[model samples]
Target: MKLPETAKNRLEDALKQLNLRPTQQREHVFAVLLSERDHPTADEVYVRAKKSMPSISLATVYNCLEILVSCKLVKQVNFDREPTRYCPNLAEHAHFHCNDSHRVYDVDLPQDLLNSLKSVLPKGYEASKVELSFHGTRVDTTPSK
Candidate 1:
């Protein structure tokens, strides 16, 4: 998949800032993540990347993911005992994992709520980042006999 020139330029700039060399594999991996808003695991990324890059390997996918995460171009979402998922959304938000489908969804958190959450921290404790995830089943509204 071809990435927009603007996005490609931005990602290239980010990699340069991180003193990392931008490669086609890395670009392809990021494109795959951005292609689908859904958070995907490294294995999933490998599968998608293979469509564009038939020679791509799982190790390459993992390396690309690590580089992206280190450069702050991607975020890794982890659920208890589940495969780590990668998200390209840079916006401040949390994640909701459906217990049934095993899918992850982004949940926006208000700034006020985030501030209130920080207030619970003890004195002199500062948090540079916050990661919140909720696991539950989607409620079914259908009437049952």
Candidate 2:
């Protein structure tokens, strides 16, 4: 998949800021994540990336993901030991996992609200990150069209 010039520049700038060189494989993988906002597992990412780069190996995808995570360009999400998923969103937010549909949705909260969670932490203990998730079945509340 060809990334737009601005997207490419963003990726390049992020990598360069991290002292890492941007490569084709990394760009492609990142593009896949960008194309789909849903949190997808590595295998899912490999399948999507293969559509454009058939030669992309699963191992390579894993490596690229690792680098991206290390560079803080992407985030790795884990749901109770389930396959690790990749999330491109960098903002402070939570993930809601639908129990019935098995879909993960990004839920955003005000910065103040998220910061309030840190108050629960024990004194002298600083939280590096705050992770919140909700798991429930979605009910059909709307009339059928």
Which has the greatest lDDT?
1
51-98, model 2: which lDDT tens digit per residue?
Answer: 999999999999999988987879988899899999989997888999
> Model 1 over residues 1-145: C-alpha lDDT tens digits?
9877887887899899988887999899988988998999999999999998999999999999999998888999999878999999998999999999989999999999999989999999999988788999989999999
User: Which regions of candidate 1 fall more than 4 Å away from where they truly are?
Assistant: 140-145
For each candidate, how many residue pairs have backbone atoms clashing (under 3 Å)? 0, 0
Cα error, candidate 2, residue 135 (Å): 1.0
In model 2, which runs have C-alpha deviations exceeding 4 angstroms? none
* Model 1 CA lDDT for position 40: 95
